[model samples]
Target: MPEMNRQITLAQRPYGVPKDSDFKLVETDVPEPEAGELLIRNEYMSVDPYMRGRMNDRKSYAPGIEIGAVIVGATVGQVIESNHPGFQSGDTVQASLGWQTHGVTNGDGARKIDSSLAPISTSLGVLGMPGLTAYFGLLDVTNPVAGETVVVSAASGAVGSVVGQIAKINGCRVVGTAGSDEKVRYVLDDLGFDGAFNYKTSIDYEASLSELCPDGIDVYFDNVGGPVTDAVFPLFNLWGRMAVCGQISQYNATEPPVGPRLFWHCITKRLRIQGLLVSDWADQHDQALREMAQWVTSGQIKYREDVVEGIENAPEAFMGLLRGDHIGKRVVKIG
Candidate 1:
């Protein structure tokens, strides 16, 4: 016998773009299950650019959140009741618990969350998906061959910031682009990117890219698409590699931004452009976390967090992410 709970759901299927009205906050009786399931109260949830794509009624790497249904998200929580053998009432776990206050699990998808070793919230940021995304997306995809030149857009974001630093660690010359002068300096000075530029200050994406990457680019980790992507195309060295990560510039757009006028350059260079969702590499999450954590503890890697105060402000924090308002990993605190 237990008390039920309420959760939030999608208010509407976004048309072209999402609005705050598209999300519906609702209350419902807590879910109870037959057997081999666990019920828990979620603590913290992560807000990511990829979540924006889920708002639209379209097929993607994962199913989109349906209208009047709870929005999907990654959450860390503690089990309060359990009939499952693997989980107990006090067990801490991380899973796709969604944008609600509570959730029930079959005990299949949930993974143990260890707060004793590191901050529990890190499961959603540095030590979790974002970390793995930056790792595999940059190292595995781009290769960042030693002494080569690497450039990443959205240089100071969760994944971008880590990607640039890792590239430097691998002995590649790295440059990055950000929205503000402060972010530019953070990547260049703090993160040790060989160079950094503020894209907002220079409208001509090609000119800016040319100035910063005069040696040409061997690896291009594309975080934002549109004009920056177009600018990066011509600078690609022969057989250059491009990893198409989250495209925040066009995430809120009613339509995808158009650019890349230099498709011919790609053909001539025989460049390889690949798109990957970090979830696709879930199998490697643990390995990446272990190595990343070691680097972080030793000062070989650095992380920055842009934290929003409360759960109620999750939407505003998400909005800031789309507008490039955050300088690093963005998270919201919930109690």
Candidate 2:
């Protein structure tokens, strides 16, 4: 008898916000690697805001998850069987193996993990896509300079947390927005942001930004769009740069969101706003990873993880992430 494999598959395309019923867990025989392929036993799998977008049927940067397909996500795994020259049975690797306990891959899009540098899970968080997202989004896209005021939304999250710390490292006065007071404290105290506010309580985002960013926002790292962005626009300094990363605020909108039109701020303030995907800087990933690893290992950059145990709980974990129930990088530990 072969070992059993468990997977979470997309059961239905979400109409708005996803529900547990939208996902189905299925069991199958663990697959054997063919020649030139590797068999992986996934240890940690990521659940992120972008996965919400993928649950819809519309095509974006990546294709939508099809019904019954294993939900797409980054995974940290150990190679259990390998016929590929680049991998060995004992090697730990990071791959887009989705929401599964076992996967077989051709070694494409898979990278070996150096567990000595950091925990294997960081490969899915700080040193992985989220960290790189923060790195290139802030530095490459926005080019935040020293002495500037940098504000990041979702500041306690995987990407935004790193964004704030990196901005601080660059000598910028960093401000962050999170959902709760506890998250705000984590951002300000633990992550070293100069200022942070709970957006949920800060009913007037403009007032919050006005108080925190007295010099005006020079660089805006936007993770949650909508009202928060509307408020930030008015506070943009001349020649400000905005990195539009994720719009978790509008990811689950049943209808297109209507808000104040603020493009005039772009004209008057000469603001530069651009959307970003981590893969946009694929050519620079190795360099970024090396730098991020050093920062993380040396305590220059701090990270927190919200790990949910068991593959069976992945759906609930993902839903909780969407609801802002987790404080940091939300991942599922598959046993």
Candidate 3:
């Protein structure tokens, strides 16, 4: 094993969108694991929208990242050394090891990965938190029946892509909205979305949705919350279900977004809107992972990864992700 561990640390609190200067890449001597701990060599780490919230000075559901601390993230890595009874050297495991090439953790929250089941990198994407988020957000939060029209925003993205495919499997008509025309095409042609549109070029979101969803939307999986979400409110059928999965549209905003107060429509249409945190379904994650793995293996669900080659590039790749530069899951490949 290498003697140095490279890490990305928070240099400053970001104002609006994060910039290159906000992060600092530094190296330290790889430390030995204490008792009941495992020393892991991170192979792949995830860059997610939620991490942006953690970069701020204020706190949300989780604590903010302190200055000079390694940025928090999920990683799939191999154990280089272990002191825990449950783990051993060469074991591939998944844990919140943050943005570093090496990390040490007690066995408490770490999960051993069965690499033979799928590529280990998948533990950060389709078969990991993103997959769990989609499963519970759609089926548990909002149960769409067969023949229902399900609309997903950011449809070609990690969680959204899975949500659309799962909805299709359940016999619901799935439509998606993507940031670019290419993404729209992928959602329609590749992922098998019933219909999709490029939100960037659409003159009227309401008109686009109306054209695609001739029948009213019975279930809406919201990933980007903004005008696109506003457009959905007016088109919902009675007792419509909505899983509020993400609000990437507002994550980097310098000011609070002001828009149409569409809650009145929810009252009349009987819409159910609920925010989701994948951790909320932690107890059932193993079951969800097993089922999603089957879907991936059987080709019932297809996924892609947008990978950045090095840990040093994670910040840049993450910024691009916020700008909607990549499709599917964005992950950093570190070794």
Candidate 4:
């Protein structure tokens, strides 16, 4: 193992969209694991929209990443040394090791991974938090029934892709929206979404939704909240359910964008909208991961990953993610 540990720290809180200057990469001697701790050589780390919220000073469901601190993230790695009884050298595990090539933990949030079952990197992508988010958000929160029309925004993304596929598994008709024509093809042709459109090129979202969801949207899995959501409000069937998983469109907004007020539609149509975080279903992660792994291995569910090589490029990868530059999950390959 290398003697130096390289880390990406928050240089400053971003005001709008994050810039490369917002992060500072620093190096230090790799430290030895103390008693009860394990030394990890991280291989893959996740960059997610939720991390943006952490960059800000305000607290959300989780604490914000303070300036000069290592950026918070999940990582999959191999144990280099172990003092903990439950782990040993050569074991593969997943942990919240942030944006670094090495980490030391007491195994509080870490979990052992069966690398033989799937690619070890998947513990940070499809078979990880993003996958769990899609599973619980759609199945537990929205509960779409057979023959129901299920619409997902950011449809070609990590969580959105899984959402549509699982909805199909449940016998629902899945419609999706992506930022590009290529993503539209992936959503419809590769992932088997019933219908998909490029929202970037679509002139009228309401008109597109009307045509795609003639039966009305019975379950809406929202990822980008903006005009797309505004367009969905008027087309919801009575007692429709919505799972508010993310708002990527508004993550970097300096000021909240003003749009049509649709609370009346929610009341009149009897819509049920609930915001969710994957952490909310922490108790169910083992069960969800097991089931998701089965679906993935059986080819019943498919996933895509946009991997950027090198830990030094993590800031660039994160910026690109905010710009909708990735097709599915965006992860940084560190070691």
Candidate 5:
């Protein structure tokens, strides 16, 4: 008898927001790695906003997840067995192994994890994709100079939190917007942002932004689109730069969202807005990770994790993530 592996698969494509019935969990025999392949026992699996897009039946930057297929995700796990020359048993690695407790990969897209530098979980969050997204999205895309005002939407999230901290490290006055008051405090107090506000409770977006960003926004790292982004456009300073990361607010829309037209701000302010993908800077990830690791070690950057235990609970945890229930990076500790 072989060891059994529990896996989560996309049972149905989500219409608007995902529900419990959209995902199905089943057990299967653990697969054996062929020659040149490695077998991994996933320890922690990441739950991200981008996964919401994958659940839809449409083509985008990446292929959509098919029905009854394992949902795509990043995982950190130990290499329980390896036939690949680059890895060995007892070594930990990070790979896009989806929502399975055990998976076999050809080692093409896998990276070895150095546990001595940071926790293995950080490879799925900070020092990993989200961290890399913030590093390049802020520094490369926006190119904020010291003394400029930087604003981040979804400031308490995995990516936005890092974006605000990196801006602060660069000597910029950072302001962030979160969904709740507690989230706002975490961004201002724990992450060292100059100011933050809860967008959910705020009656006037313009007033809130104006009070926090009196100097106007020199650079904006947008994670949640819609009204939050709408409010940001009119607040831009001359020669503003915007990094369009994820549009979490509109990710689950069944129809196109209608909002105030704001492209005119781009023309008037000479704003440069660009979308970013972490893979765009894949060639330079090693260098970026080195610098990010240093910041984490020196306490220049701080991170939090909202962890759920068990593979069975992944769907609920992921649904909560989409609902803005989790404060930080959401991961499932798979058994």
Candidate 6:
């Protein structure tokens, strides 16, 4: 058995955007799994915007990642040995192993995966948290309809990209906003968005909405929540629905960014706005997986990953995600 372990440890608490100094790459001996546990080496690890919130000391829906804690993340792993019930040697699984080369699990959170269906790393993406977020966020919250106008922010991201395409598949008129013209083109030309705008260069987000969603927006998937969400707020038609999946723009703000309030419109238009966490919807994942898988296989829905080459590169890629430097779901390859 290999006796080496390479891991990234939290070295310091970050005040804003995390820096290299915040993480320490440490090497040690591989740990032996206890009874009812599995010993595994992590393969691919996920890097997401929400993990940034965990770094801060402030309270959130989930407990923050304490200083010195290995950064928490989703990972794809191969079980090297197991004493856990239902888990076996050589079984591939999705485990919450965080940022490390080796991990031990009680088998409670480890879900067995079949590599025959889709890429296993996809468990961290389109068929995993991001996929589940897009699936339930769109269906349960937005409750879209055929031929209705649906608008989304961060249109080419892991969550937003799938969100928009699923809306399209439902027969909605989809329009999206992304950070670059290239991303806008990808949304419009490739993702089948009826229209898309580069939010970075657009003179007015509301104006862009007016031009693209002349029929008025029936649903808004709010991914980048600062200014872009503000722009979509007023354009919503009566009885509109909004799914507040993520707010990437404010993730790195040193101070709270100023945003226009549209509380009155929510009442006047009878709009609904609610934030959703994918973890809270575990009961419905089987249905989501079956439906989403069919869509991917049928080519009616598409997903993309902005894959970074190594585990050491996750922090940089994640920092870029906060800066809108990436156009799709960011994944770090650890194998």
lDDT values for all models: 0.82, 0.93, 0.94, 0.94, 0.94, 0.87
Instruction: Write the number of the candidate with greater TM-score, choosing between 1 and 4.
Output: 4
In model 4, what lDDT does residue 195 have?
A: 96
lDDT digits (tens) for residues 234-329 of candidate 4: 999999999999998999999979999998988999999999989899988999999999999999999899999999999999999999999999
| Model 1 stretches astray by more than 4 angstroms | 1-6
- lDDT per residue for candidate 2 within 1-335, as digits (tens), equals 66799999999898887888899999988999999999999999999999998888886888999999999999999999999999999999999999999999998889999988888999999999999999999999999999999999999999999999999999999999999999999998898999989989887999989999998999999999989889999999999999999999999999998899999999999999999998888888999999998899899999999999999999999989989998889899997
Query: Relative to the unseen true structure, what is the C-alpha lDDT of residue 195 in candidate 5, on a scale of 0 to 100?
Result: 95
Q: Name the lDDT of candidate 2.
A: 0.93
In model 3, how large is the Cα lDDT of residue 243? 93
Q: Please, what are the lDDT tens digits per residue for candidate 3 over residues 148-245?
A: 99999999999999999999999999999999999998888889999999999999999999999998999999999999999999999999999998
lDDT of 4: 0.94
Q: Judge candidate 3 against the unseen true structure and give its global Cα lDDT, from 0 to 1.
A: 0.94
Between candidates 5 and 6, the TM-score winner: 5
Return the TM-score for each candidate structure: 0.93, 0.99, 0.98, 0.98, 0.99, 0.97
lDDT of 1 by residue, 239-312 (tens): 99999997777776776565546768778999999998887877877788889888887888888888776555
Query: Model 4 compared with the native: what TM-score?
Result: 0.98
Which sections of candidate 2 miss by over 4 Å?
Answer: none
lDDT of 2 at 140: 93
